[model samples]
Target: GTRGPLAGIRNLGATCYINSLVQSLFMTPEFRAHILQWRFEPQQRHAMNLAYQLQMLFKRMAHPSRGFVDAKAFVDSFGMGTAAYRQQHDVQELNRQLLDVVQTFIDKAGTEQVLKRLYEGQFYDYKRCKRCGSVTATPSPYQDLSVAIQEISNLPQALKAFTTPDEIDGVSCDTCNDKTTVEKGLTYRTFPQVLTIQLRRIDYNRTTFERERVRQDVHLPLDVDVSELIEKSVVGSPNASDDQDENRFELQTVIAHSGTAYFGHYYAFTRVKRVERDAAVEAKRLEEGEDATEATVGGEWIKFNDERVTVATPEEVEEYIDPASWKRRHVVHATKKKAAEKTKRDAEKKKEADNNDSNNVNDGGDAPKDATEPVTDVATTTTEGAANATPSGNAGMGTPVATDEAFAFGADLFDNTGAGGGGDSDAVAEKSVSGSSYYAIYRRVDLPLPSATIDTASLDVPEYVLEATKTEDDELSRDAAELASLRSVVSVGLVYRGKKHWVSCKPETTLHELTSTARQVFGIEDTLHLRLRAFSATMSVLGATYPADFTMADTGATPGSSFTLLGVEATTDAAIAKDVWPTQSITEWDRLMPIRVYQPEKETFAYLRDLV
Candidate 1:
């Protein structure tokens, strides 16, 4: 069992980015224990203190009776204004700001450098001048790595690319006194107990003058080793050990985005530990009448989606890694669908035959319970659910209803479709789960716990948290009836001039209505005629213009499907410009062959060349 029931964070508007980061941080065992044990001084204990607010939030999250907790207090203390809360910001930015604020507060409170001890690491930026052979090594500190992942296949590959040496264009060498290229790269000087990596999935396209997303799915593993990436000079030195076993890390949590570069939803997958100690060791300690803390290295996985927290299989977690994996999960397999239909028909026929046989037999007690599949086991439950729910017509916009495995949190807690579809035909809206991974957190393997146990007395929830909880409960009671209407409204992106703006509407909204809404979002006047073209998530060939009166439901246009609205006048201008000065290349033959070519308005190509 977990130390406490898992809890989710309420989204304060477009605050999914913050919620995802907070969930991952809360799951970090070392970080959680340290924050809980920090004894705040009289002066440091205040509502404005970020560390105190975060500690209180964590304490509420660990409450046994709560399904979720409100983070508005903490968010307010974090200083993200109400306007910022309504707009989506990058998760990495929040991660850095939160850590920095906590570090600042910890310093003021005169506590140990908890953030530095767990999340900070040192690296060297070295430049070797080829001419002078002089090397300059600059040591720098970092709490996390922001790495470019374009064209990279995995975590290690991305790290390697980040550290790859690049030549400099010009420099005055200190020894050689010449401007020449120099090889520069990075190497790890020390590894932190917890490592946070931010995958930069968005890139700027110079030609388009807009930010575009790299939809490549990079493979992530349960464990990662950075020993090989350490500086060669430090490996055998007294500063570092030759055998760097401590450099290994295990996946603790992941924060993934699920939309385009302009807008998206954020969610997290976290590894939850049930027991933190070896069973034999714990048993022996208990037998000796010593207090033994429940701890373990192995753990189950869970997903935190806004206010919904549920158990997630290791396989299901992979779906959030990248666009390819997410798209693969939504593909409609015709063969499998047909086979499932056939199986259902056969089962019905068998049931009819069994009923006929029962009518002839005199012995009728009850159906054997042994024939039914066991529901107690997790794997068994998942298999049974999958068998009953096969891919159906709603595969385009909704997930297979039968595949939602029930757990303590309830199966209906999450809207399976990213577009807010609740497994109903009327609400069958397509969801775009295909997006690049945004953030990941890793814990050092075999990291030793603090020598002194955390003081349980210091882990009390603050009064502010209690008051906030009551307010949240009241709000929830009032908003319960409005959730259905909220789910029916889905957001789709409208692209113009290489930029995407999202517009919200129901699935039954017509193309004309959608266009009108999109135009308003873009602040376009009614006089400008707009040309609409649709494209798949993968940027497939642009589909033909849709009829203005056709509803989104009729064409199965789901959330994240891009509809480009091109102004008729702007498009015509581009076409005319292209035709006026179409790029032409001059053709000439060698002097020895001296040839000139000319053509009359109606002359054939062969005749024109001969005449020239």
Candidate 2:
């Protein structure tokens, strides 16, 4: 978790599901600003008024009075009934209901256009008769789209699956008196400024007759083409943009759920778009001799987990979605291993070329400007740990590898630059999020952000809120002071066998102390000797071997940094055993690390032996 700048929401009992939804919406700048700009009438001001409570919650979250704000007031005012308030509620269901309530409140205020302008989308579910050649269209309005997760590896695939046409057999057509097969599917009539998608990960199992959560990994693109998913051939379809830029939608928020259908915890990772302050703020910065262009803040993502909000990387968000996907972990290791081997080969080739050039120069001949072999740009994969990459092959022969250090945690393991080498590095840098995304928010690039019609300064500020702000300011000052005085203790990870474990140590803690702690934690006997090596999961390659005399200060080890332990084997049978698959009851199967097996649809159960 990060100690970065963003306020959090405190969960009141089993209210984390609510907290996740609240935080995600608050981080959407345009929406937050719109809510804060609401002008409530004197008669509408009441303790049970949802809109007023929401405005207050957004006000406090934007200008946090403390590290976290109490959301109990908003919860009490939500009017979700007593039973719903007392327990954890489904996020998707609550999300739609909350929007409906907000729309209702704004409708009375005559500003309901804000909700429609930001979220409302029109779609048509159509059926075409084959015999009579007649088409029927049913127009519907939706604020969000719920897509299925079955048989899809990514979001685009899921969208296509949702919109793809299927045959409806033995159906009576309105135009045709006899039954005939009909083509049935949905097409977009209009797209919204902001699009929300819910990945339907929970499906009913036919064998067990129960609903179960699907743990399949579904990749979520940072930018998606909404136009491509729409059926353009339909007569009244929204005009498809010839310019691809206008069709793009960038991701803003991801609400991830962890645990089972009965019990689960919800958290959100939201993107903070760059903000441009007014001229007055810019003038103030200029007067202080600060860079005028430094008026903008944000353009980063943050994780909101109940009372603890921290700065988050895209990789961290991806990993949090499907932390136990073995394929993702394996791809990371395999890609790193390939990159390391390439580096070594490139180094050896460079040395040989240098020696050959020296020999040619000694013989009074000019050295070649470029190598005879063709050159290619190779991408690197990284993880939570830090990594670096140098250009491979001959010098001055090809484009230097533009590394995206952010491509970590099961993203495209290697950022393939593709053929032309001119692809935008920034675009490649933010990899697609993978896993079961319960909720996703995307904003259209062509649409302008919402602007406030009323002046924010005229709003009456609460006295208690002012006092809380003062207290928060004092806390910030104390935190800054504590940060200046560096603490002695720090935590780092130790990867032993196939698992990683974290241990605490001081900056001055020697390699000897680290090894001793590792031994104690891993329950290794004193007789057995352990070897310590500096390893990076980011590179999936080993670093310089450390001597017992080396200290953490010497190595510059910090929090979230990890090392690998070598020269050790499993001490017991339990350590070597793997979790077996449950054949009888599917519910009893391990959800995170399920046993590998052949495709049930394509092969028999006997094929499992071959896979094992």
Candidate 3:
């Protein structure tokens, strides 16, 4: 048995092969379905997949054909029936060849279109010279129309039809000879302002498509500067951070993407306002004896020697010289010395007249009986008194009596004393009253009052302590009795809240002032209640419970009966008739809403809420 198995292995070379029939039987419908399901869907994707598969299949089938097997062989190896395999292979080959031709046409057309768009809307035609191969550009269709037409007529009708007029001029380079011409035709197509490119992808029965659009604003015609637009829109995004390197990179990318050359749809049409040259007229002007510089050619006038020329009218002069230049030369004529002298003389004369007027008026509307005589005997007496008033041992006498009188009548004159003495009795009285009040309080408390004196030694309290104490007393007065007294005088309630909020019915008092005070003290959102009323004898007496200094007694006397609140209708008819105080109108009260108070120290409304 061992010798038999070894002998068969040597002769057959241990061959292992499956029969075609067995392979076909093993290829189930489920395996074929799996292959078909994975097939690429879009035409492009499908073609690519097929190409790859063919390459792989050829590699495995390498031999004399180097694995480049035909489509027929590929189908047969897949176990497809012979007839179906042949038919499918033929169809696929035809489709592959057709696609190759279509791709070539598409590539050619795309290149041509791009070139045409680049040269669109150009006014000039460009060509190379045949003689020297030098490039030239020209505006008109024919460089020399007369010569080109003559040459065209010499040609046969059939040849002439094929020829086009030459437009470019020859460049006068040293290497070029001006004898030959190159014949070429220029054709162009303009590009649209906005270009949209659509990209499509399809795979495994799924498709995705995206469209990208690029737009350009042609701000100016041909050869115009677009640097600003490029710097702004192309260089950076409007929202990009200035401090980031990425922002700079993004800006550069955008600029590079948008900086492509574009030939617009329409040609720029421009007409230069050229100043014509008139050689003959200018030559004639030069020949004239009158200054050549003053001569004019055509409508333009010339100037010479800085001399003024007589013109028929101001308009003629203006036409010859710039209007702005004429105005600068003619207007605002004045010399500094003349202006200063005039001002000085006028001031001097005014001073003299004022002195004369003063002397006449002081002389009782009459000229002085003796010019240089003393104006009054009182002046002499005053001078004598001042001279005698000086102390005996003083180095100099007191100010001259006449000078003193002059000083009194002039700017620096004032009495710094009280009555006949240079001391303030009222100030002393005020200080004494304050001291006596404080002393009386201290005596009652059995704490000795500090001594009252003008010198610093007499004061025992520190300056800051004294200031703080005074401030505290002032604040206390303001918060309580003073504030209540002021409110009564104004006839306005300062309470903040409820109906009749921030309404002032008091005479000569406005709703604005009451609400303003509430906002200042409470907050913008705080509610306030204010009421105005005609004073009644009883309420007026009760108001007097505050202080006379804070009452509005000047407004009017209070009646002995009940007072009525103006602008506020009573809630009910019975209430209106009754002698009760009226509240504010419901509408006015509804307008106010509470606001969160702004507290600077605590930096929030938390402190305000806690205080409330």
Q: Rank the candidates by TM-score, best first.
A: 2, 1, 3
| Residue-by-residue lDDT tens digits, candidate 1, 1-612 | 223246688988998988888888777767777666666676877767888888878876765445688898888886767865889988888888888887776645566787898888888877888776777787788889988887887888887787788888697777678888888878777778898998888899999999988776786655788887776652232344355557788777778888888988998877655334376874454344342232322345677888888876533565554334333333323334445666896699799999989885646655447857543565565556555554566443533333444343344455442345544222222335544467888778786422112233455445554555667555654575466555566566676665667666777888777667667777776656654544333442232234456566655555434343322112333333223112221122211122222222442222212432
The CA lDDT at 350 in model 2 is: 95
Looking at model 3, the pairs that clash are: 58-67, 62-67, 502-528, 505-532, 506-532, 525-595, 537-559
Over all chains combined, what TM-score does candidate 2 have? 0.54
lDDT of 2 by residue, 8-57 (tens): 88877789899999887876666666666666677876767777788877
Against the unseen true structure, what C-alpha lDDT does each candidate score?
0.64, 0.64, 0.27
Off by over 4 Å in 1: 1-4, 108-111, 175-179, 233-243, 273-299, 321-436, 448-612
List candidate 3 stretches off by more than 4 Å: 1-120, 123-612
lDDT of 3 by residue, 1-612 (tens): 011000000011110111111111111122112222232223533233433233222222211111112233323333434443223222112323422432343324434332122111222244555665554444322111111111221212212232234544544444454544563433111111111111111112224343222221111110111112111221122322233221111000000011111111100001111123355774453343122221221122211000111112222222222222222222212233345656896699799999998886787655557888656677667767665766566615664466656345433245333355554222211110000000000001111111111122232333332342456445554666654544444333343333223333344444334434445654543332332222223322111111112222322423222232222221234433232222222222122322123234553332212333
Off by over 4 Å in 2: 81-86, 109-112, 169-179, 236-246, 273-299, 320-436, 447-612
> Which pairs in model 2 have colliding backbones?
none
Give per-model TM-scores.
0.53, 0.54, 0.13
2 against 3, candidate with superior lDDT: 2
So what's the TM-score on candidate 3?
Answer: 0.13
